[model samples]
Target: MPFQNTMGDYQTRQTLETFGFLPALTQEEIFDQIAYVIAQGWTPSIEHIHPSQAMNHYWPMWKLPFFGSVDLQQVVNELEACHRAYPDHHVRFTGYDNYTQSQGSAFVVFEGRR
Candidate 1:
């Protein structure tokens, strides 16, 4: 079956991917994307990576993965907390599927302060 597109009116995967590197995302934008992911029943996670070590390092999992949040605000709250802590590093929002046990989709919502 073909993939069902969600995040209506939001940027398409192709568009989002255009940012091979993280694009500048406002706090509102991040929250908007978070809201969309939560509505889809996907788990949200934050990843951090340094620009200098982009070649030698991997996207380190910063915090514990969020699974099945009952409240959308909770997920946004967690993301905000993570961003404040790592304000100068690269951070991206990734949503995972609980059933297939695979990454459902991912997007670099923000690329911390350059």
Candidate 2:
């Protein structure tokens, strides 16, 4: 069957792929979290999602297909939830650092940092 174009599925897959949720993750809530990820700033590194390969980590590879939006807090929540569900998936971040002085692609991530 052809894929059903639904936001719920997108949110679920994105959350699972990026955050590593197993089964208990609800489809509806993750969508909300996705919105929060972009709204809060900070981009999910390519490695954050796909850790096996770095050579094709840029774009047009493992991304592009699964590129969906999720604001910062939601990303943090999703990651934390996944960490709780699976210990090995526990990832410790360097925390949110404001590098607003940088440019290109990252300009948004560093925005508001003085």
Candidate 3:
């Protein structure tokens, strides 16, 4: 029998979260995504977690979901505030759809030190 490479040896490192595997989104792009979420009537929320524990635990919500919020700038402000407070933590933005009662969209907005 000839020696052959098998799939079992492959290993992947845990990444930040959704959108983490892809190139970081630009500020404008992030804004656009938030806008879309709001347009869909999804409430926006921010969460943060230390990079080391990102995959092991649930991130704590920054404050609370911005219910009834249509101001894009307000959401951005909260995101910025969370980043400032947790400079070494990964910050994520999520949209909660009331009708579905689940997260409709989510993405990492700021990446912490790995």
Q: TM-scores of the models, in the given order? A: 0.64, 0.25, 0.85
| Candidate 3 TM-score over all chains jointly | 0.85
Which residue segments of model 3 deviate by more than 4 Å?
1-13
Highest lDDT model number: 3
Best to worst by TM-score, what's the order? 3, 1, 2
> What lDDT is reached at residue 10 by model 3?
21
lDDT of 2 at 19: 32
Candidate 3, residue 33: Cα displacement in angstroms equals 0.4
User: What's the candidate order when arranged by decreasing lDDT?
Assistant: 3, 1, 2
For model 2, residues 1-114, the per-residue Cα lDDT tens digits are 123357676564422223333343354544354444354553443112222231232322112211233445544464555445434321222222235522112101110111
Considering summed lDDT, which 10 consecutive residues are worst modelled in model 2? Answer: 104-113
| lDDT agreement with native, every candidate | 0.64, 0.32, 0.85
**Candidate 3 local lDDT, residue 56:** 59
Residue-by-residue lDDT tens digits, candidate 3, 41-90? 99999999998888855789999899989999999999999999999998
> In terms of TM-score, which candidate is strongest?
3
**Scored by Cα lDDT, where does model 3 land?**
0.85
Model 1 lDDT per residue over 44-102, tens place: 88776654543343588767888777576776676567677877766667888887887
